[model samples]
Target: MKNFDTDVAVVGAGLIGSATALALRQRGVAVVMLERDLGGSRASGVNFGGVRRQGRSPAQLHLAARAHPIWADLKAKIGIDGEYVRSGHIKLARSQADLTALAAYAARVADFDLGLEILEGRAFRERYPCFGPEIIGGSFCPGDGQANPRLVAAAYAQAARQAGCEVIERCPVTGITREGDGFLLRCGDAVAVRARRLVNAAGAWGAGIAAALGDDIPMRFDYPTILVTEPLPPIVSVNIGIEGGGFYGRQVERGNLVMGGGFGVASGDGASRPDSGALARIGGRAAAILPATRHARVIRIWAGIEGYTADKNPFIGESANVPGLFHAFGFSGGGFQIAPAVGEVLCELICEGRSSTPVEAFRPDRFQQQSAEPGRTP
Candidate 1:
């Protein structure tokens, strides 16, 4: 039997788990991270790589702000740049109503010091002439940007390993249960891991882990479709998103355009792929927004499995019923930008008994309280 022991066992080797492992090791804690599949093969690698503070819920702004510096120093942390750019993010407004809504959102988040610039009419066209005339205006957050999802998680995993954290790939924990004063993770009789604490960072399978621990959080799966086009002269300058949330895209320095929106297909075994119908819809919207993409050939299309909660927020604290068991999943598709800060928060919670960052809104018991209320469904 392959038996191992550690101070903390982290399930999932995605960016969040890997970063947490690295952070723990930096603080002189023993960490062993387990992944069912290759690290970053899921949502962490397949996401559109939007590292932005724009178009996020107010509750997430603090976390996003906290993660900005981490992205700034990512190369020093992981030894690779990860193709991250602070190229700014613009949320397009197709109509006057959309512009008004964007303005209102900017006003609501003004206290966060995001420095959102609202451009409309002649000023908007002059600022972003590449967009179609239909896009009346947009709200630009200069601090927001994009990164290469494919390279980030693996880099962090390697960095964690270098820092003395045991990262085991393809070691799926089939079941987890309390053993004495610690937790026992069983890998289908092939391996067993014992740890004083556990971190549920599994991307799509996180709900099952929480359920096993009696958290029973309400979460559903999503397959977000992303497509990339053949290399061409760069036309779009920054990451783009629609105000109403139908489409979003960005162009890499190599001149390939990455666009994503709409749900795709997910299999029973957790595999996912881009749906043809969704791709067609995205194509029509892309052509409408950016005429330059009308003739660009799409070279690849893919989708990743993500767990989303009803309120569209994530659970990022210790479990309500299970002590020493931390929950950090259910990001509802916006986890990438805030993942670094989340790793720091998880480390603080594990090593120091609490996180200095404000995470009261992400308490694991929030949904449980809602479920307990009359006429409320989790």
Candidate 2:
């Protein structure tokens, strides 16, 4: 058996974890990153890859804004463009109620300087003629866009490795415990890691680490599916999303349209399959939202496991129970866009004992407090 000692041990190698390691290494910190599978091979690689700040809840906008510049400088940081583009993101409203909600959201986030434009009637149709008749109006964030998710996470991991972070793949941690003022991570009998601090970024499996630390986090697993259509003539340049959460899609430069909505079925043993019914529903909705894609042949369908907290907001702070433990998981399915900033924030907390970014809203122990409140279920 081999033993490794480090200043910090990161428990996952997804975009968030890899980014954290990269940032920590840049600051001359001794860090070790462990992953069960190849880095970025899980939810981080299979997501829709929308590098968007639109359609996010108000509380999440700040973090999304923080990540925007990182995406802009992605190539310089990770050494690959990752097929990222600022194709804009439009949230369509099919009904008056949806339009009202979208308008409210746009107004609420105006202070964030998103420069959102709400268009309807001829103005909306003239700009985006590919949208179907059902799309009454839309709020557009002109700077938002999409990227290739499969390439991003892995690129971050590679950059972290090059920057002197010890990345161990296919080494799943079986358990974690507090020893003295540090943490001891056991990866079966082959390897053991000891670190002064621990970061839980294991996506859907992060709850297990929290549990081992005596925290009963109310986290659940979700299998969200994405469908890709065979290359067709480019129809939509901007990424599209529904106001009330029905469908979301974007066309890549190669002419393939990527669409996703709803959840899939978990196929036991930590695997999941795309739900056919949900895919069909997504197709119907896409046909109504983007008529040009109605006949586009679907070439692939896949799903990835993600962790969602009760309120859908992620846990992103030091543990209330364990002083040396930090968490950056349970982002529902909207984490890709904000992951870089999260890594920076985590680095701030670890090295400086605080962060300038507003992370109080993502307390890891908020659910515990919620469950203790009257009639509240976390």
Candidate 3:
């Protein structure tokens, strides 16, 4: 066996794993990342890339807040543009109920240091004439923005390589076994990795890894369908979403309008394909929100699988049953925004046994009534 040794072995070289490897290497730890395919070919590469904190749940607000600065400085840190633009994010309220919910959320997050502007009626129309008349009100966060998901994970992997981290692509981890003081991972019978610590950043396929280590997290797969319209005049300057998340969209600098909503079809191997019905619904909703999009022709459509936990919050922290095993998955379609921060936090957990950021609520055993007993072998 071609055996390699490292202080940490990260499975799944998506944004979280690549970022974790980069952080660990920067901290002088030996890190090796293994991926099933080319890095970021899954959810991380295909996400909508809305780097916003305005609509996050209370438990994820802190992580999102901490991640905002990272996105702003990503080009400087990773040496890649990733097309990051802080064009602001606006969530439209289509009804009185939606407006009330936006107001309540704005009040709830007021102390969180996010400067939110509540626009309604005349203010909404005057500020954003591009939106349709159906939008009664909206909440805007000037700092929230968008980025290019297709480039982020690969950039992180490059930065990790530059920091002396070993990244192995197209090496699927077939089996994992606890060996002495560490773990032995078999990668498709060609390579073996022994590491004192393991970080499972396996996006939608995370539950299988957790189950192998005696932790059964209730994770479901969601395939969000996305469609892009043909190039048009630059009408949208900010990322747009609905209050209840029925639809979300943004226009690229090249004038293509990208939008996604609803679920798609998932294959047996966890891969996903765009659903025609879902794409149609998203286009209809997009037109309703912005009349200018009513006649835009859809140029392309796609979908990818994302892991969603029962509570819609990610499971980030050490394993309850297994020693030296960590997890950072189940972001429920919101991982793109906070992936870098998650990597930093995971590095803290692996190196120091604790993270400075508050991750208590995202523990792997939170869904269980009692923690699983240790000593279970993979």
lDDT of 1 by residue, 75-106 (tens): 99999989999999999999889989999999
Q: TM-score per candidate, in order?
A: 0.97, 0.97, 0.96
Q: What would the per-residue lDDT of candidate 3 be over residues 1-378, giving only the tens digit for each residue?
A: 678999999999999999899899989999989999988888888889898999898789989988889988898879987999999999999899998899899999887787888889887898899998888889999999998898987888789888998888889999988988788999977899999999999988898888887788777777888888999898989999998887999999999999998878865565678877888889889988999999999998888888877777899998888899999998889999989899999999998988888999899888787432221111
Clashing pairs in 1: none
- State model 3's lDDT: 0.88
Query: Candidate 2 lDDT, tens digit per residue, 35-154?
Result: 999999999999998888987877888899899988988999999989999999999998889889988988888889999999999999899899888889899999998899899989
Score each candidate by Cα lDDT: 0.88, 0.90, 0.88
Q: Candidate order by TM-score, highest to lowest?
A: 2, 1, 3
Error of 2 at 311 (Å): 1.9
Clashing pairs in 2: none
For candidate 2, the TM-score is: 0.97
Off by over 4 Å in 2: 371-378
Sliding window of 10 residues with minimal summed lDDT for model 1 = 369-378
